[model samples]
Target chain A: MALDQSFVGRTYPPSRPYEVGREKIREFAEAIGDDNPAYRDAEAAKALGHPDVIAPPTFVFSVSYQEAESVVRDPKLGLDYARVVHRDQQFAYHRPVRAGDVLSVTSTIESIKSLAGNEVLDIRGEVQDAEGQPVVTVHTKLVARAVEAGGTGGAGEAAEGE
Target chain B: MTAQIAYADVEEGTQLPLRTFPVDRARLVRYAGASGDFNPIHWNERFAKEVGLPDVIAHGMFTMAEAARVITDWTGDPGALLEYGVRFTKPVVVPDDGKGAVIEVAAKVAKKLDDQARTVQVDLTVTSAGSKVLGMSRAVVALG
Candidate 1:
């Protein structure tokens, strides 16, 4: 099923503020095998001018993706979760997320289109501190591959994105 | 401190050191737990194949995190990064073999986006098994 184009520009409500925790940042860094001191030690982060331990740049994706689930789960939008694959991801940060900062996300559907028989959706997320200060802007692109009639739907060699 | 690279020392075409990140099933499970992205395609080979993927695949964000290491290790500060973007053109298929897979990264300062703030845009060439995994991979960093 094709997505509803009118849903483009729909902005979801701000999510509950999430605390940026040092332990979570450390866990994320260690999971990726990154030993950057700034990600683990408060003093190391402070030395770099951050008030508390800083998260790796990609850290916000975890939080934002969770929040974006609201859009994916929006029955009105009719997005089939299983058909979706990640296409592109981008982030612009005014500042790195610190250990103690509280953050919230507001997601907007940027665009909806069909390409190569796949439905492509773009969502832009605005992340702000508790004070409503911009922390980062995230853009995520997802593609929903067309399900063919003969069950060759997901099995095609076209190799859609992930 | 802020950025180990001297603002004056870096210019367009300054090459960053190459780095390699090893990926395996164990690491994916760990990342899935930490990142909360338990999309079975990343850990379950059977599920991945059922979804038309060749084998167990690493998360795109996982490969992205590995690519950024080349910059973070060089800057010596993880927070120095200002912007990062990439298109998932290819998946890094991680096999069940004990050796797993390796993502090789090479980067260079593609442009100096700012002169006063000491910011530069770095372009990356990331590959897995000699195949480009991320398209238009780029990052803007604060060298202040």
Candidate 2:
């Protein structure tokens, strides 16, 4: 099924504030095998001129993806989570995210299109600090393969162009 | 600590030094916990295979984070990076045989901009076993 074209440009409400923590930053850095001291050492972060321990660049995705639930779960949009393929992601950071900062995200549907029975939806997640300053903007493109598409009924079905 | 690599010191097509890192099941579990992705496909081989994955795969964000490390390590400050993005072209599948996967991250100076801030554009890639796992990875960093 094609996603609702009318849903384009629809902006969702801001999500509840997510408090950034030092432990989570450390864990994320370790998970990626990044041993940068700024991720775990307060003094190292301060020496680098950060107010607190700073999050790794991709940390904002946790909050942003949650905000995207607004669009993906919308009944009007008619999305099938089982058939979704994450196509692309981009981040434009106005400022680096640091620990102890509470942040919120607002998601908006930027565009929708249908190509070869696949529904492509572009969703934008804008991250802001407690003071309402923009921290980063996450642009995510997700493609849902139409159920009727041939050879898509089973698992392991790669999306087109894979 | 500001960037050691200044905008005036580099130009288009200058390749940054490469850094390779390993991605194992332990790391994937930590990533799932930290990022709250908690997807079974990233940790459970049985579940992953049932869902059609060739094997337990690393999260896309995990690979992006590795690429981010390459930039931050060079610049010496995470804040030095102003923008970064990537297209997840392939999955980093971690075979549970204790012989983890590796992502070789290499970067190049794609462009330079003129301004008081002195920003440089960096192009990055994450490859594993001759396959490009992440593509079109870019970063803009403020230089000293």
Candidate 3:
């Protein structure tokens, strides 16, 4: 089923603030094998002009993707979660994310299009601090493969009838 | 400071070395916990199957993070990055086995910035089962 075109350009409400903690930042850095001291040592981060231990660039994904649930999981959108492939991701950082900051994300459906029988979703997640300062903007593109019509269980067929 | 490759030393076709990193269920769970994602599709195979996924999958950010490692390691400093982006072209399906998945990433100097910093663009992809899990991915790093 094709997604609802009307859902395009829809904007979701701001998500609840997620507090950045030292432990979470530390864990994320360690999980990716990043031994950068700015991710774990507060003093070191301060010495480098950051208020606290700063998060890696991808850390915003934790907050942004959750905020995107308002769009991707919307029943009206008729999206097939199973067939969706992550297509692209880009981040524009205004400043480094710090441990003591509380952040919220507002997600919007930037575009919906069809290419070569596949559905593509472009979602923009704008993250801000508690005081409403922009921290980063996350743009994600996802492709949902079109379902094949009983063609002997081909490419997109595995995603159907879920 | 001494630099191996400087802004003036690189060109468009310069090929940086490739990197491979592991992605397992345990790491996915830890990512879910730390990031507060908690999406059932990343951790529960049953839920993933019920929702039309072949099996539990790794988070897109997980793949991107592994890709970013290649650039940061090459620069010798994480702070040397200015901007980065990628398209999650495929789902990294992690089958339930002790063996984890791997993401391979490579980079090059795509463009030069006006300042002393050069914009090093990276190309990255992840694969499993001889299938391309992610594609069309790129990252831009700032180097002195």
Candidate 4:
């Protein structure tokens, strides 16, 4: 099913503030097997001029992707959750998110297009701190595979590979 | 933030070290829990196969993080990373056996985007099982 083109340019409300904690950052860093001292040691981070231990570059995706649920899961949008696959991801950081920062995300639908019997979605999230200062801009692309009509339907690959 | 590399010393085409990360089922589970991405394809072999994948696979984000480590490890400062991006070209299929998948990452300075801010673009070649998993992978970082 093709996505609603009108949904393009739609903006969603900001989510409640999510507090950045030292332990969470440490856990995420460890999960990725990154032993960067700045992610665990405040002193190490401070030595690098950060007010506190800074998050790894991809940490905000946990928050931003959650906020994007408002759009991807909208009943009116007719998206098939099971058929969706992540395609592309990008982040533009204004500054590294540090421990003790309270952040919120406002999501927007950047674009929607259909190709090769698949629906592709583009979502951009603006991540900000408590004072509304930009922390990072998260852009994600999701692809919904085309169902085969008794034809050999390959597992969704093309869109993801693109 | 202070970077380990001095901007005055680096030029375009500077090569960063190559890194190889081991990806096991346990690591995938830990990543799913920490990142709040509990996609079954990452941890469930049956589910992954049922979904058309060869076997259990690692999350695209997980591969991306492994690739970014090359830059952060070089700069010695996470704050030096100004931008990062990647295209999910292929999935890193992780088998259930004790020896899981291995992701190899190599990076280099592809462009000198700025002088005053001391920012440069680093391009990464991320491969798993000799197949490119992340395409057009790159990061823009500021140097000391």
Query: TM-score of each candidate?
Result: 0.96, 0.94, 0.80, 0.96
lDDT of 3 at B133: 58
User: In model 3, which regions exceed 4 Å deviation?
Assistant: A1-4, A80-83, A150-162, B1-11, B15-17, B37-57, B90-98, B113-117, B125-132
The residue-level lDDT of candidate 4 at A131 comes to 96
Best by TM-score: 4
User: How much DockQ does model 3 earn?
Assistant: 0.39
Q: Model 3, range A1-162, lDDT digits (tens) per residue?
A: 567788888999999899988888898898777887778887877766677788888887878887776678887788887566567778887777889899999999999999878898999999999999999888877777777675435432332211
| lDDT per residue as tens, model 4, A48-130 | 99989999999999999998876789888889876778889999999999999999999999999998888989999999999
lDDT of 1 by residue, B1-144 (tens): 488888789889999998889999999999999999888888999888886778988899999899988998989887788899999888898999898999999999999988888899999999999899999999999886
Fraction of native Cα contacts kept in each candidate? 0.70, 0.66, 0.41, 0.79
> What does candidate 3's lDDT look like per residue over B46-104, in tens digits?
88776666788887777778777776667654555556776554677887789877766
Give the per-residue lDDT of model 4 (tens digit) for B1-144.
899999988888899999999999999999999999887778888777776677888889889988989999999988899999999998888898899999999999998988989999999999989899999898899998
* DockQ value for model 4: 0.69
Which stretch of 10 consecutive residues in model 1 chain B shows the poorest summed lDDT? B1-10
Query: Which candidate, 3 or 4, would have the higher DockQ against the true structure?
Result: 4
Q: In model 2, which regions exceed 4 Å deviation?
A: A148-162
CAPRI tier of model 3: acceptable
Model-by-model DockQ, in order: 0.68, 0.59, 0.39, 0.69
Worst 10 residues of 2 chain B by lDDT: B1-10
